[model samples]
Target chain A: MERMDLEALNNELLDAVLEKGSLSFVVNRLHQALNKGVLICDCLGRILIGSNSEIEYDIDAYIAKAIDHSEAYYYDQEICQLFFPIGWGKLIAIIIVREVKEEEIENILPVLETANLSLCFYFSKYNAIREVENKYKDLFIQDLLFNNILENEEILAKSKLWGWDFKKEYFVAVIEPDNFINIKTFAEELEYITKKLAKENDIEIITSVRSGTFIVISREKNNQKERVKEMIVEKISRANKYFSEKYDTTFSIGVGHTYLAYKEIYKSYQEAKTALAIARLIGETKFVKYFGTLGIFKLLYKQEAYLLKEYYYETLHKLIEFDKNNNGELLPTLDALISNNMDIKLTAEALFIHVNTLRYRIRKIEEILRIDLSKLENVVNLFVALKIKALLKLHYSDID
Target chain B: MGYGFLFNIDACIGCQACAAACAKKNDFFLGFRRVQKYELKYRGKNVVFYYSNSCNHCENPECLRRCPERLYFKRRDGIVIHKMGECRACLTCLKACPYQAPKFNHQIGKVSKCNLCVDETGDPLQPKCVKACPTFALQLVHEDYYQPMAQYYHLPIDTIGKSHITQPSIKIIIPPELQKNGEN
Candidate 1:
C-alpha cells in the first residue's frame, strides 16, 4: 500500500515539472512530498529555486567536494542536511534537504532518487525541444537581419510559428553577457528568468540566442513612441536589476527605435547593434541604450573618417600624445572624470587610485592642455573630443 | 607617440623669427617654416592671428607612402625625413601630400622638403623655429598627444584646408580671442 503511494507521488512531481517548466515547482513538490524544507541550486551552489530556509552548511564547498568525486550520483548525510547530486550527462542541480535527522535520510533516499530521475528526464526532453525551436528561430532571425528576402506577409507568417505577432510594430534589443564564470549555465538561467519576467510584465517578446548574444524582440501596437519606450525600458530595467542583484551578472542592452512595418524592424535591429557598439566604446555597458537619444553620437558616427580624425585631434589629441610619450594615465583619468560627472572622489575610486593621485593627474592634464578643467567650456571640449576619439577608433581601426 | 610641432596661432605675432631661425639653421632658400597671417571678422571686429605651418610628419605620411622612389621615411619619433640621395624627382609624394609638403628643389632637380633638422646621428633636433618664437608660440611635441582641435566658438576649422586629408602631426591651439564667440 505504501509502495503505491510513492509511485503516485513520483507521478505527481513529474506532472508538475512538465506543467510548470520550473525547477522551483519540482522543488516545492519535493518539499511537500517529504514534508521537509527543500531547495535547488546550480553548479556554483547558488539557489536557483528554493524556499526561505537557512542552509546549515557551506553548500559551495560541499558542491566542490562532490564535483571532485566525479560520480553521477552523490548522497551523503551531513548532520541535518542531505545533499543529492543529481546528474544525467550534466550536473543539472544539487538538491538539499533540510531539517531532517540523519536516521530519516535512509528512508528519504529512495524518494530523492526517484525525483532525480524525473528531473534528468525532464531536462533532456526540454533541451531537445529547445534545440528544434532554436533551429527555426535562428533561421527567422537571420532572414530578418541578413536575407531581407521575406516580405511583410512572409515575416508575419513565420513569426506565428513561435506564437509571436510580427504584424504589430516592434523594437529590437541585443544583449551581450560579460564577466561570466560559465557561459552555458548563465545563458540558460538568463533565458528562463527573462521569459518569466516577460510573462509577468505582459509584454510580448520573442527571444533567441545567436553567437552567444541574446536578441529580444518586443511587439507593441501603441502609436506613442515615448509610451512604448517607457514600457520597454521598465521591463528591461526590471530584468537587469533582477540578474545583477541575484547573480552579479553584468550585461549591456542596446535598444533600437520603434518601427511600424515589419520590414523596418530589421532597421531597428541594425540600429540596436550600432548602439551596442557605441555603448562598448563609451564604457557605458551597464544600461539600456536607445538609438534616437544617443544625441550627437548618432550624427557623429556616420561622418567621414578624416573628419572624425580631425575633430579628435582638435580636442583630446594633446592629452593622448602626452600619455603615449610619457606613459601617462591622464587620458583615462580625464575619461573617468567626465564619465562620472566630474566627481573627483568617484573617479579616483573607479581608477583604483588615491584621490591625491587623481588630483595630480588632473592638474597635469590642465597644465599640458592649457585648459581649465573647472570651466564648463573646456570640459565640453574635452568631452566632445573623447567622443570623437572613440568614433575615430571605430572608423579607423587600422590607423594605429 | 611620434614627434610633431605645436603652434599657438594666437601667440604668434606674424614674426618671421621662426623662418629666420630656420634659414640660419638649415641653409634653405625660403626657410622651411612658412608663417602666414589671417584676419577673421568676429563680433563685428577683425581679429588677426598668425598661422605658422610646416611638415606635419603626418600619421599617414602621404609623402612616404606614395613615393615611387621611396625618398621619404618617417622617423620612429614621428619626423618625416627625405633621403635626397635616393631622389628620382618623381614628385608622386609632392602631389599625394595634402599639405604641399614635398617641395620640388629646382637646384637639385629632385623633390626635397624640411627634414626636421637632423643631427649627426640622424635624430631630429626639435628645429630652431620652435626655439625662436618670441611669444612662446611654436613648440615641439609628440605627434599623437599634441593634436589640438580647431573647434571653438569661432570654429576656425574652415580656414585650415585640405589638412583633413593627410592627418598631419601638427597641433594648433586656437587663441582664446577666437575660441570665445560671446566676447564684446
Candidate 2:
C-alpha cells in the first residue's frame, strides 16, 4: 500500500481541483481503485457528487454524526458503512463508503485518507475560485454603475450568472469612510454587516467596492418609491452609527433615486456618486445626503462641460487671466469675499489680509472684470461659476 | 509583510543598464523596462532627474482586482505575477494601474508585465534589475526599512486613484535637488 504524500498531493492537485469535472473524475478514480461505492456530500449531507450505488442509501444521520464529531466512523457489521470528514472545522463535507468488508477496512483506510485530502483540496480551491468570480461580478456591477457602454445581452448574461435580477427596481447607495487605512478589509466588513441587516429587514442588496468607495444596489421590495427611500435611509443610518462606533471612524452615505430597469440604474449610481461628491465638498458635518435634495446643483451638473466652461470664462476669465499673468491673489480674494457673504471684514479675516488690502484687491477685481460684488445677481453668478469650475476640476481630476 | 524594492534616484546615472539587463533576462521584446529622464527648473537652477520604476507589487493591487480574466496573483512574499495564457486582452488593468506597470503585448494580443523575476529567482533574492544595476541604485529591502525612507523623501505615497489607492509596495529616494527645494 502506498502511503499518501499529503504535501505532494496539495502541490499537484491545487490547480486541478478548480478545473471542471476534476472532482467527479477524482471520486470515480478513487472508487475504482478502492473497489467500493463512493459518495461526496456537503456539510449538510446533501449529495453533491458520487460514484456507483452508494448514493441511494439514507446515510444522512451517519454523515451528520461524523460531521458533528469531525472524525471518521465505521459501523462494525455486515455491509459496513464508513463516514470520513473532509475540509476544516465548521466547513466540511462527508465521504460515505458503503458495503465495506471488515478484512478490507485496513486496506481502505489509506485510500479514504487520500480521498479526504482530495476533497479538502477541492473545497479550498472551490472557495478561492468562487471569491474570484464574485470579484468579477463586482467589477461588472461597477461598469454598470458608471454607465459604461455595455451591451444589454452581455449585462443580462453576467447578471444572470451572478444571480442578480436587474429588471427589477433598484437604488444605488454610496458609502464612504472618513479615514479608512485598510479599505479592502473595511469594505468586506461593511458588506457583511449590511447583508446581515438586509436579511433581517427582508431587503435584497448587491454590493461592490471600487476605488475605496462602497457601492450597494438595493432592490426596492415595494412599489412605493418614497417608502423605499425612507427605509434605505433609516437602515443605512443605523448601520453607519453602529459601524462608526465599532470602528472608531465616521461614515457618510449618499442615496440615489430608485429606477426600474438595469440600464437606468446607472443614472442612480451617478446620482449617488454626485451626492457623495457634493457632501464631501460641502462639509463632513452632514453625514448623509440624497441626490433629490440637490436641486440647482443637479441641473448645473447636468449641463455640458463646454457650455459651463464658456459661462465660467465669460464671468471670471479676466480675473483668471490676471492671476495667471502676475501670480496675483485676486481669485482667492474673490472666492473668500463670495464665501463670506460679501462681508469685506470677514473675507479679509479669512484671507489673513488687512481690510485695506482686501478693499484694494476687490477694487482691482471689479476694475478688471467690470462686475459689482455688491449686487445679488452678480454674486450669484460668480458663486455658480466658481462652483462649476470646482465641479469641472473634480470631474477632470478623477482617475479611472 | 514581505520585501519591497528601494530605488535611490540620486545614485542612478541614467545608463539604462538595469533596463537592458531586465529586458535581456526576461526576453522582453516590447520593452518592459522603462527609464524616464525628466528636467525641472527649481530656485533659478536647472536640474535633471532619472526615475527607473517598474511594478511596485502593491499591497492592494488594482491589477489583480480589475483583471477580467483573473490572471494575476500575489506570491507569499508580495511579488505579483500574471499568467499570460489567461489574459483576455481587456487592458483594464493597464488603465487601473497608477504607475502604468502592465504593458500590452501587441504581437501576442495580451498583456504582460514585470514579475520581479520570481521565476528566475524566488523571494529573499535580488531581482534581475536590482542585480544588474552598475551604480548599486536598486536594492531589495524589507518593508520596515523602506517605509521611513519613503516618508523622509516625501515621495507621494498615494496618488489620487493609483499608487495611493492600491498601496504600492515600492519605495523611492527623492532627487537631492528636489528635496532641497521642498518639491517632490
Candidate 3:
C-alpha cells in the first residue's frame, strides 16, 4: 500500500534465508512492526500461527464473511480486529490483527500486504520442500511396508540416506482420522507439528502418509517397558488432542510392538494397522491401543468379519433367542460370570442378585448352550463368542 | 457393505490385463472391469495416471433404485450383484451407473456387471481383476461406518468422475510423486 513499505518488505525477503525456518517468526516480525497481536488462520479459522499472546478467539463464525471479502473487520464498538485473506480465487486464509484502530488502517494496510507476501513465499517454499520429501518418503515407506528388502543390511543402508537410524528400536504407530475435514491439509499440518513437537521433546521420528492413515515410526529411547509405553501414549495423545480440537475431528491410534531389527519394522507397521482395525471394530476410539495387549482380538481380527459374525451366532444365538422369548437377563449374567472368572459371589454382586439366582442363571446358560461352565474350554468358547457378539453389535451397520 | 476396492494409481501400468481377466472369468461378451486414464496438470506439470475401475458396488446402488424390477442388489459384503436371470433388459442400470460399469449385451438381451468373484470365494469375497494385476496395484479394503475416512486416500472424485453421487466404494490412491499440497 506504500512505496517505503514495499522497499522494507523487499529488504526482508533477501534476508529471509538467514532466519530460522518457521512461519511464526514472520508473523512475530509483523506483530513487532505493528505493535498489535497477529495470527494466521486457515480457512477453518484454526490459528495456524500466532504471535505475542496465544489468546483463544472464537472467530469461526466470521470465517465465511472474512473469506468472501465482505467485511474486513469484526467490529464491537469500533474495529477490534482486521482480516486480510491470503490465497487465490476462493483463497481466504485470514490475517487478523487485534485492537488495531480504524484510523491506523491507512498505514497498517501496507504492512499487512507485506506480511501476506511473506506468508506466500514461506508457503511456496514449504510446498517445494514437501513435494520432494514426500516423493522419496512415500517410496521408502512403500518399500518398508510392502516390498521385502531382501536383507537387514539393505534397509540399514537406505535408512542412512534418509537421515534415519534403523539401528534404534522403532515402534510403528498408525493414526486414522475419524471424520472428514480437509484431510490433505490436516495431514500436512500434522506432519509439520508432529515433527516439531518430536524435535522439541528430543524424540526421533520418521513420518509418512499412506492410504490416508498417518504412519509414524519413532525411536524408543527408554529402556523400561512401562516408561516407553507411557512416553508414547503421552506424546500421541497430546498430538491427537491438538488435532481433534483444531480440526474438529478425532483420530484412532494403534501402536505395534517395538522391533529390534530394521527389517521387522514392516511387521510392526502391519500389527499397528491390525490394532487400528480392532480399535475401530470395538469402538475403542479413546485410547492408543497396542497390538501385544489385544490378546484374543489379535487372532479374531485376522478372520473374515462375516465368518466371525457367523461364529458368534452359532455359539450364542440360543441364549439370545431365549432372552428374547422370555425377557431373561441370562446373557448379561453369563457375560458377568465370564468377566468375573466364574466367581459366583462377584457375578452376583455385579448383577445385584443373590448367589442362588446367579447359580440358577449359570445352569440355565450351560443347558441352553449345551456346555458345562465348569470346563475351561467351554468357558473359553463362551467368552470368545460373547466378545464376538459385542464386536459385531457395535459394527452391525456394515452388514445391514 | 463396507467392502471396497483400493486401486494404487502409481503402481498401475494401464496394461488392461485386468479387463481381459474379468471377461475371461465371467464368460461375458463385455468385461465388467475397465481401466480409465486421466492426464492432469499438477503444479504446472502434466502427469498421466491410470485408474482400473469396476462396479463400485456402492452402498446405495443406482441400478437397485432405478431398475423398475429391482434386478440389481447389494449383498452383505457390498458387492452389487446383477441377477443375470432376472433382468428383463430394462437397461436402467446401463443408464444409471455414473462410472459406466454396467454393459447391455445385445446377444443375451440383458444387463450384467461385476459379481466381484463372490461366487468364487463366498465368505471373504474376491475380484478376478485384483488377482490378475501383475503389479499388485489393486486390493480389497474393508471399513466400518464408525471408522475414520479410510477411503479419502483415493483420488478426489472430481479428478475422475462424479463419484460422490453414488458414493462408490472404491479408493483410488493418488500417485505419490505429484505433491498436491499447495493451492497452485
Candidate 4:
C-alpha cells in the first residue's frame, strides 16, 4: 500500500470513529468502508455489533487466544480477530473480521489496526468527557452543600437538568478512610463502590468527594426520622464491611439529621461535620455517629469559645494554678471524685491512693477553692466545668 | 475598532446549537460556550430568556490583568487569546472576569476559554458559534458597527470592577418586551 493511500484510510477510519454517532452506527460504517464483515464484542466475548449473522465463529475462544498471546488471531481466510486493550490490560472490546482474501491481507491488517487504535482513542476521549462532566456535577453539589448556591429556584432547575430530585428530603453523610495514602484515588474508588451499593439497594443518593472525604446526600422518603436514621446506619455499616474486606480500609461515617426541604440541606451538612468532630473527640467505638445522638455535646459545642474558656478559668483556675506551682494532685482527685459519683471510698480506690491521702487532697481542693464539695450545687458546677475543659481540649487539639 | 460577537437575544430560540458547535469545534468535553436559560416574572407573565455567551475578548480584559502567570495576551486586532501551556490553573482569572469566561478544566488542571476561533476567523471565516446558529442570532461584527446597536440593546457601560474598566467588546440585543419591562 502507498503512504498516501494508508493516510487516507487512517483519516477515514478516525472520522468514522470520532463521528457523533452511536457505536453500532460507527461499527456498521467501518464494515461498509472496509468491505469486510465486522463483529464487535466486549471483553467477555458477547457480540455487541456484528455485520455477518450467518457466519459461525467461536469468538470467545478466539478472544481468549488473542489475549493470551497479546496479538491478533487469524483462523484460515474465514475469520480474523484483534483485541483492543485500553489503558493497561483493560480490554475495551474485540473486532472480528470475516471474508478476507490472501492478497488483501497486508492492506486489511493496517485497516484493522487503524480501527482498533481509533476505538481505543474514542473510548478514552469518551471517558475523559464523562469525567469532566462528573467534576462539574461535583462542583455543583459542593456549592449546594456549602450554601454557596443561594438561588433556590436556580438550583432546583439546575438539579433537574442534572437528574437530581431536589424535591426529595435529604441528609448528608461524610465518609472518611482511615490512614489513606492516595486520598484522591481512594475517594474515587469509594464513590464507585458506594454508587454500586446504592443501585443494588435501590436508594436515591447524590454523592461527591471533596477534600479527601466522600460525601453522600441520601434521600429520605420515610416520614419517620428514626426509620430513616436506621436505614442510613444499616447502609453505612454494610458499606463499611465491604470496604474493609475489599480495600483493607476502615471508614468512619458521620450522619446528619434528615431535613424535609432541599433548602435546609446545608444545615444537615453542618450537622454531619459536627458529628464527625464530636465522634472523634468522645472516642466513639462505632464507625457511624448520628448527629442526634451527640446530645449535650452539640449544644455545648455551639457556645462561643471565649465563654467556655472564661468558665473553665473561673471554675478550675485555682486548682490548676496550685497543681502547677506545687505539683499537687487536686485536678486528678477532682476527676476521680466526679467519675466515682462523689463516693470517697470509690474515688480513693479508683485513683490508687490511700483513703487518708485522698481526704487530704479533697481538703486542700475545698480549702483552696473555698467551695464545699459536700454541697450538690458546688459538685455539679465542678463536674460541668471539668467536662467543658475536656471538650475544649478536644476542640483545640483537632486540626481542621 | 476590531471584531466582536453580537448576540441578538430577540432572535435566539434557546436551542443551544451555537453552544454545541463551539464545544465540538474546540474539542471541549465541558465548559466553552454556556447557554444559560432563565425565567423572570414580569408584568404578571413568566418570560424565559436565553443567554449564549463565551469570551467577549474585551478591549480591556480583566483576565489579562489578573492572570498571575501572564497567560493572556491581546492581539493588535483586539482579540484576547490565552497561552495554553503556561496556565497554572490558579483560578484568579475565573474570579476576575465579571462574565466568568475562563473555565477551569479539572481533567487538564488548567483554565480554558474561547479564543474567538482565531485560527478560523484569521482564515476570514466566522467563529464556529456565529456560523452554527440556526436562527442567525450570533454575528461577528466590527466594534464600529456594534456601538449603535449597543445603545438600542441597553448594553451596560460598566460592570462589577469599576466604570468601564474592562470595556467588554461584545454587544447584546435584548427583546423589546424585556427591555420595556426593564428585565436584565
lDDT of each: 0.69, 0.69, 0.70, 0.68
Candidate 1 C-alpha error for residue A4, in Å: 8.8
- Over A183-212, each residue of candidate 4 has an lDDT whose tens digit, in order, gives 665665666666766676666667887545
Please compute and give the TM-score of the first chain of candidate 2 against the native first chain: 0.46
Task: Write down the TM-score of every candidate.
Answer: 0.53, 0.44, 0.58, 0.41
Compared with the true structure, what per-residue lDDT tens digits does model 1 show for residues A1-400?
2678778877877887787666767887788778998877766576767633576565666777777766443555554566787776568778878777767876787888778877876667777997887877866775564324335688777777778766677888877675563556556666666676566666666776654567777765333333455565566666666567556787788787777535566556656766775666555657777777788775664355577778778777788889899988888899899999999999999999999999899999999999899999999878888877654543343333
Which 10-residue window of candidate 3 chain B scores lowest in summed lDDT? Answer: B145-154
Q: Which DockQ-derived CAPRI band holds candidate 2?
A: incorrect
Docking class of 4: incorrect
Clash count of each predicted structure = 6, 1, 0, 0
| lDDT of model number 4 | 0.68
Return the clash pairs for model 4, or none.
none
Interface RMSD of 2: 12.0
Best candidate, lDDT: 3
Write the residue-wise lDDT of candidate 2 on B1-184 in tens digits.
3567778879989999878888887665755667888675655668786778788776556676556655666665667778888788899988767677898988889898988777775556767888989988887876632232223322222232123224567676777565633655
Clashing pairs in 1: A314-B148, A314-B149, A317-B145, A318-B145, A321-B145, B3-B77
The DockQ values of the predictions, listed in order, are 0.01, 0.02, 0.02, 0.01
